[model samples]
Target: MAGVLIGLALLAFWLFSLFDVITAPEEEVRNVPKALWVLIVVLIPLLGGLIWMLRGRPKVVRDPWPVPPGPGMPKGPDDDPDFLRDLDRRMRGED
Candidate 1:
């Protein structure tokens, strides 16, 4: 019974860490980020369960794929709306 309880505790910790790492933002990956490293821990519950260990980890932020923002325009999602309004203002030469 004691072993079973310990196993359950490890599983719970693994699942919690897994969910956190999977959803965490990329900018914070340098930090703990809910201890994604837990997946790499041997004899732990999540050791062999992570797909990233075999396949690959995705670039959750700023994928290298091409974007249509074009040159001389803002380069972010925020830039999109501001760029449109800025273009309108520029054409009208308004402040």
Candidate 2:
């Protein structure tokens, strides 16, 4: 019973690792190439998953700087003078 449970757990882990390797962006993967990682995960299952977990996973990179607002972006209609002017004109029934 315990052996069967262990085997099932390994199978799940292998499948999860295989999918992660395939779906991960090429530039993000580390160590061996993505193609080789796929083969290793497919061919060796348990050992392959262990190897990937240990060596092939990518480290996530986070952007430290805040993104600047794009051109002509307004925080809100109330805060934008042009938008408020347009709203006033519209309210007065002027096209």
Candidate 3:
């Protein structure tokens, strides 16, 4: 029947919400603590699931890309002008 299908759907939604709450990281859960959220979801399935969806999830934060190293860094001895000059002098046998 239509009523039975609706009930099952609601039950499935509630169970999914309950599992999400139980598995969510402690710090990521907002408004209520993880344990309390689990109780809420289990005790009053439909309403609690709605509440968790509305207020229990953490906002996602995207980090900015890190700055690259400055030109002061040399990739290798051959790429450094000073090192190249020193190598040339050494090759000419200068002290």
Candidate 4:
């Protein structure tokens, strides 16, 4: 039972690593050429998966907070001058 569970886990890891390697964009795959990484994962599943997760995956850059719209850009309908003007005209029954 324990052995089967371990085997399934390893299998899942191998499949996930293989899929990730295949789908990753060429520019985003780090440390090795995408083809080489695929080969490594296919040939040595456990170790290769670990290495790929640690070193070959793309580095994700995340902003700590959402960026506000640039100057002159409306964040919502309420912030858009044209939209407000149109709404006012509609309220007054102007064409």
Q: Give candidate 3 regions above 4 Å deviation.
A: 62-95
lDDT of 4 by residue, 15-88 (tens): 99999999999999998899999999999999999999999999888977789888989999999999999999
Tens digits of per-residue lDDT for model 2 on 1-95?
99999989988898899999999889988998999999999999989989998899898778767766567777667878998999999999999
Which predicted model would earn the best lDDT?
4
lDDT of each: 0.57, 0.90, 0.89, 0.96
Q: What's each prediction's TM-score?
A: 0.35, 0.61, 0.62, 0.69
The C-alpha stretches of model 2 lying farther than 4 A from their native spots are 62-95
Clashes of 3: 0
Candidate that beats the other on lDDT, 2 or 3, i.e. the better one: 2
Winning candidate number (TM-score): 4
Tens-digit lDDT track of model 3 for 1-95: 99999999999999899889988889999987899999999999999999999999667787667755468877778879999999999999996
Question: Candidate 1 — which pairs collide?
Answer: none
Extract clashing residue pairs from model 2. none
* Candidates ranked by lDDT: 4, 2, 3, 1
The per-candidate count of clashes, in order, stands at 0, 0, 0, 0
